[model samples]
Target: MFEWMAWTTPVVVFFTCIVLMLIAMTVWEIRSPTVMRKGLLPIATTRGDRLFIGLLTAAYINLLFVALGEKMMAWFGLEQEPSVWISFALSMLLLSIIMKKG
Candidate 1:
């Protein structure tokens, strides 16, 4: 059913993480509801809100890495364009930070 999509390992991992996070958040919300609060972000936000923003930011970061990979390699004089794995790691880290402090 999914053969039309590439289904690469990174793609699978990224979507899996997102699905797991959504499930976890749903369970946590049922157990203890989140209250909106202000953090580093200008507006108050609930856990789900933070997660949504973080996910969007992570997606953009990955897109930027893909779009700029060649230019980045040229500037750094690397043997090859930066690996998508590097962007994945960085984007995940950024998501973590947003979830923690957004």
Candidate 2:
């Protein structure tokens, strides 16, 4: 099962972080309802909406990074593809920004 995936440590950690975020968000929503409001995002959105958007953004970021990893390594004359952790950190940072201001 799941053999098609490499199931790397970074991949596991990234998914674990997402799961934890969803749980935390669910609890936060129950504790305090959110109101639709405008932020850095063009449209007014609730916390849940922002989370969804953030999740999508993070996925795209990770995919893009992975797709370009080899090219990036070649461009930089590296011995191997860039670390997946770079994508994870970038995705998490963007997710935090989206959560706070999107």
Candidate 3:
């Protein structure tokens, strides 16, 4: 069904994961509803709100890494490109903290 878009494997997998997460969230909500809560962020947020914030935060983190990775590598005298795993890990950590506290 996704063939027409001609997306690469990673792109396809990323979107598939996102779709699956949304489905899972929907099911969980139907089973047990979530309440809005205020966290480090200024406003109250629900599970869906937290998910959106996490995704946006992850995207920005990845973009910032991509934009500055080269400069950072050069400054540190690194020979290879920076690994994206760092950004992924940081994103997950931020998501966890937000979900737990916010």
- Output the number of the lDDT-best candidate: 1
Error of 1 at 48 (Å): 0.2
Compared with the true structure, all predictions reach lDDT values of 0.92, 0.91, 0.88
Clashes of 2: 0
The TM-score measured for candidate 3 stands at: 0.88
The full ranking of all candidates by TM-score, starting with the best, is: 3, 1, 2
Q: What is the lDDT of residue 13 in candidate 3?
A: 93
Question: Residue 5: error of model 2 in Å?
Answer: 13
Which pairs of residues collide in model 2?
none
Worst 10 residues of 2 by lDDT: 5-14
For candidate 2, lDDT tens digit of each residue in 42-95?
899999999899889988999999999989988999999999889989998998
Q: Which scores better on lDDT, 1 or 2?
A: 1
Tell how far residue 52 is off in model 2, in angstroms.
0.7
Candidate with the greatest TM-score versus the true structure: 3
